[model samples]
Target: MKSKILLNLSLFALLISSLGTSLHAQTYGKNGMVVSDHHLSSEVGVSILKKGGNAIDAAVATALSLAVTHPEAGNIGGGGFIVFMKADGDVTTFDFREKAPLAASPTMFLDENGEIRDNSNHKGLLSVGVPGTVAGLYQAHQKYGKLPWGELVQPAIDQAKNGFPMSFGLYRAALQVSKRDSSYDILQNFFRGPDGEVVAPGELWKQPALAQTLEAIRDQGRDGFYKGAVAEEIERYMKANGGIITQEDLAKYEAVERKPVKTTFKDFEIFSMPPPSSGGVALIEIMNLMEEADISKIEFNSTAYVHLVAEAMRRAFADRAEFLGDPDFNPEMPIDHLISKDFAKSRFENLDLTQASKSDSSKFGQLYGGDHTTHFSVIDKDGNAISLTYTLENSYGAGMGSDKLGFIFNNEMGDFNPVPGITTSTGQIGSDPNLVAPEKRMLSSMTPTIVAKDHKPYLVIGSPGGRTIINTVFQTVLNVLAYDMRIDRAIEAMKIHHQWLPDRILYERNLLSPDTRDALEAMGHTLIPTTNIGVLMGITYDARLRAYVGAADSASEDGAAKGY
Candidate 1:
């Protein structure tokens, strides 16, 4: 059995290298599977599964593991949403997204002159939100976890305490930080040595502080961090840095359980995170528009098909910028209207087909809604599946951590529109529903989704790419379900994205041919080349074989899909 597993991994690695992606992108395992952007984190989850844990247990383990092995995207200092399906056919969602501090205000990021404040919401302690990751994971475990909480988090604790070798992926992620800038406190604190040197790849790095932090949370449950020493440490740093998060805010933080948005496309049920995450609404709208237009008629990856996808993406994002926000803060969002087939049809009719819409064109849009966020998908032998996407908002988050506690804070407040109701060059008011507000969660595009066919788990998927997340997942779904590509091909295929305001179609550098770019340009679409848009981590289940197929985005440098 061990030999067979090793052989499969070897073959998978070869296959991945043939595709010109990192060997870390190789697929692994059949019975139970874990796919994440970090190999160590994925292994941690696989270990949990081997220890008789369920999909939820694997997910929580993977998330915690990433907080240590892949801090660029995974983080305890951040928060995200989780969507899962139980073996008995029940689907659920948990929204543990960070919220604005009590002292937050709608105009807090606005200057005295009523203009947007420079970097006010992007950097420093003022940009931090009340983190909900610890609460979110704990709540999920309390309800569904099959393993003890301490057991689930033990792998992460060990990794932090004993140290792990920094992989090429961690090296690249660390390189993204500007070590010279001491103001980037989180980045500096994470990668810089006390002597002002930077940690490099292949080195064994340990974080005893983070290990101790995790151990406390394991021993005392949620209060260990939120109401005790950790909370006090966080408050002290904020006070010293002109930030407003208080112990009261930490004690009051709660992860909410919300209804998953459910919809159908060609007989498959799509389940996704609802609001605070514009992801589900926007994704549903885009899929509905594609269904209404029958976009499958065009050849896959052809300019025509890519153009259709890009147009659909643009329309969805335009709607998102207008309507999607924290439901509690913007209760008037037309959730029903936006996700309706009628709305998709109306929006589709405005498309010219022969040419791109003018850049400045104004239209009422129903769209839905990554950064250094990490995402993972887990499936256990019991048929339970979990899709989770979590983040620190940006690389290292807030570019600083609590000096005493040695953990970073999420810059989620940066997600809110700093200056609401401002007119843009596109002639539409920018970010109305998503404006800053006290105790309100910021709007996000992290779409942790699970899709089913015949009431069985078919696909579990999510990604990390800031605003590009929704579209990346959107295209991947199309690649597999609509175009009939294999899961690996669906993940490796060149992708394109378009957000309405930017009015430029962003495509992988070599994915589209010169002629394709010219054809798109001739059709009035502006095309821009980019190295990457996002990394998608996912797994699909084959009921007939009772096997799980895993995949990680080739665009990423490190990730693994392993199962046992």
Candidate 2:
């Protein structure tokens, strides 16, 4: 008995040591906190908070700064969603999701014989959507920001004009895009130096044109980009490049304020972006399905837990592809039914604890979104919190940029169904709900979500992973709310994804133990390995310490968590 007691004591000590190490990886702040894909962007946000700006102001600054620092995903040329929760629990969401051009059609990407034309939906000029980031940010600021807009915009302009040290991640991304075909010549030239080589890590990289555009925005607000000289420049570039976005589209663009989707799991209240973004609905559905199980009894990351969660993800994604779309376009979508606990229970009526469920593509649509998006979380001293996610559809967008503007345009139109009735095994969906329509926002999986406990903001989290965004956010929330994990542990934990089509589970490399893998395979699961899953930015309120604990995913080399 004495020996056994000593062994247990040693085990407890080791557990505490491990937890301390994990906690050390996080940044804590009593006043405000920001976590983003780039260290400089995070720092920019923290500076705003220190200047007495609230979460909304810090979020805008962080996003704009990322447009300069993390060009691969952040941009004024892209659009996305934002979920904000005030100290009093007042919740709202902004949908600045990019919209299809006025000239776009349901079958625009199809050729004469109804086949896809040179992957036109995903490449070159026509792929671009009318940008919404600037409008979105402007609207949010106008409604909730307390700081001057110019103050929020200045940091980004300075970063672009004076330049910042190039990160290895940025350098690598630029080098790869530079190697693309001549179509990306302008992009190549923008990143290449006088010696004609890609900018090296730690080297200063500047964008004078982008600086001038930012100056216009800082001076004129939304019109700076959507109306005057900048808009004219975009129209001229499009006309010369066979693109369809025009000055009219730019002028007509506006970000809509939508009611956030709210749901409850146990003692927590969750709020996320609504349709236009499939993220909120899908995330709620998956969580509802998960709520039926006593997950506390299951070992974390065990085959059983993974299998159960994957099944839930599969069902939710199946619903996502079939019914969800821009709410303005598909108003009758069964959102209520999809997110109900009864619906989740009915969907899981069949008990299959021993075998993996088969994902039938014919019965559901497949995902066709890109993994190159960015997400950031910010919380202020006033207890207001923001979860914002933006994307360019693909890495470096269409692998090109406008020489005059010095910014990449999103290939967001590719997120729309390329053809009607053409769902493919390789993850292509042709659901009517998401078919291209002039001025329609493309469906997205950018799930920026916040959780509140006892009517106070507890967790502000989001990730950039295309179709896997929903699943990643779901798992991280579960790790904290259900499994009682530390915020840092929750962010670093390996994640898995199952998107209903292709019928395979995508697990992070070495995420599963050999025994767990063999057991899962024995249960008829086809598991594929991926290098990484999502780059998450998250903050959790530590009530005992009375501080905000922020963590940036280890998967992102340049990610940081900053606070004051």
Candidate 3:
């Protein structure tokens, strides 16, 4: 068994090296591990673990650091969810998903003609949601963190104040956002150097303003961001720009502790974020449907396997569009029914193994979400694990940032259904469950999940892909638990997505052979080729090695798995 484990480790390292990038190799540690899309952030997290901080402490520190190093998605100006699992199996979730402002209404994005105006729902100050990252992190730390709050935040402040070398990924992202939306002077000033050129890769990019903001948070905890100086600055910016967010909206924001959605797949218990994230419910629903089949009997990524999984995805996503939303707003959302094994069985009963299911948009709402988000996974020696995903919706969010605040704001308002009754074949959903309302969190596909066996964490995993997030996580979990693949191999494996409304299977380019593609098409499945699906950060506990093994998806240009 030890030799086999060694062989598997060797194979994993070989695969990493063969990826043709300077990516970090699959990492292993007896004490702790952190896997994220940025090497610096991963190192910061591992440093916290070495300081005797638990997984939660490491998570807070890691997230804070990413806000400095990886601005594309890692953000204090955004919000997300956290799925936490203690070694003894106690599980909980924190919902800090950005909320619609008090002044937001169902048709706020519509113009005089009742159509979306200037893409207002996704483009400017009006698109920004109430920030929640600071509140969520602080709340989690207050309850479970062992390190000083100041200590966790200090690293981010230092990174921003002292500056860090800009990576090619960061440089490219900054350039892309600037070019995509040239109207935001804030973004232009932030990305451009003294010569009026975009900051080049490897240059030391400093953010003194962000550092000052972090310093306040470090000194005052949650109130630092939500109540005093930062809140006032945010209000001033909004009012000056015709945006609606106010000091009251910022002050009223609170991250809520909620029960995690729990379900069993074979011998493993899965825990993930619940509603206002459709992730957990949809993931379990898909898994439960897949559980009915002997997946092992079918070859991985074969036509038959893809068909079965896509069918499952189709049915689950249909349910997600119709029934899932913020639990606070839709108390009767059939949570139990949606995740139940019986429900999955019934859904699977209608799945034709040889035919593709039609995704009628009229029957289910279309998904409107940004494909840019960040996820990190951490586990300490004590077996505590955290799977957290956050985003500034649509890379760099709203293409705007505050020179005074030094952080971008989330355009998360776009996640809400914009029109009241406008479900369209072109993939626009007007589902009432996700309509904008005061303080209502928009529905999300950010599924931070932990899979456990025998009351200990076995796998901690998540990804960043908007509507594809749930499916990406679903496939990864299945890759490990069902197909018996190592965590690294599971992450590197090709992925596919099938959201209900699109009625198409999106497969990673070049993975599906011509024959397989032909076969799928023969079954009436519309196969669309795409680039990498998600940048998955995952860690698994190797019971045989009595250690944690981590993997950062090869698709991620700057991702790393750090451990100590």
User: Residue 390 of model 2: what lDDT?
Assistant: 99
lDDT of 1 by residue, 22-94 (tens): 4444464666999987777888999999999999899898998888877776888889999989988789999
Q: How many residue pairs collide in each prediction?
A: 11, 0, 0
Which ranges in model 3 have alpha carbons more than 4 Å from their true place? 1-22, 194-196
Relative to the true structure, how large is the alpha-carbon lDDT of every model? 0.82, 0.89, 0.89
> In candidate 3, which residue pairs get closer than 3 Å at backbone N, Cα or C atoms, i.e. clash?
none
What does each candidate score in C-alpha RMSD?
4.7, 8.7, 6.4
Q: Candidate 2: where is the Cα deviation over 4 Å?
A: 1-24
Please give the distance, in angstroms, between residue 162's alpha carbon in candidate 3 and its true position after superposition: 0.5
Please give, for residues 1-564, the per-residue lDDT of candidate 2 as tens digits.
Answer: 999887656645533332223423699999999999888889899999999999999999999999999988999999999999998989999999999989989989998999989989999989999999999999999999999999999999999998777766677778787778888646767787667887676566788889989999999999999999999999999898889999999999999999988789989999998999999999998888778876778899998998999888888888899998888989899988988888978988863878888877676856788999999999999999999999998887876667778888999999898889878777788889999999999999999999999988999999998888999999999999999998888988989999988888999987678898889899988889999999899999999999999998887777888888
Clashing pairs in 2: none
Candidate structures ordered by TM-score, highest first: 3, 2, 1
**Per-model TM values vs. the true structure:** 0.92, 0.95, 0.95
- Residue 86 error, candidate 1, Å: 1.1
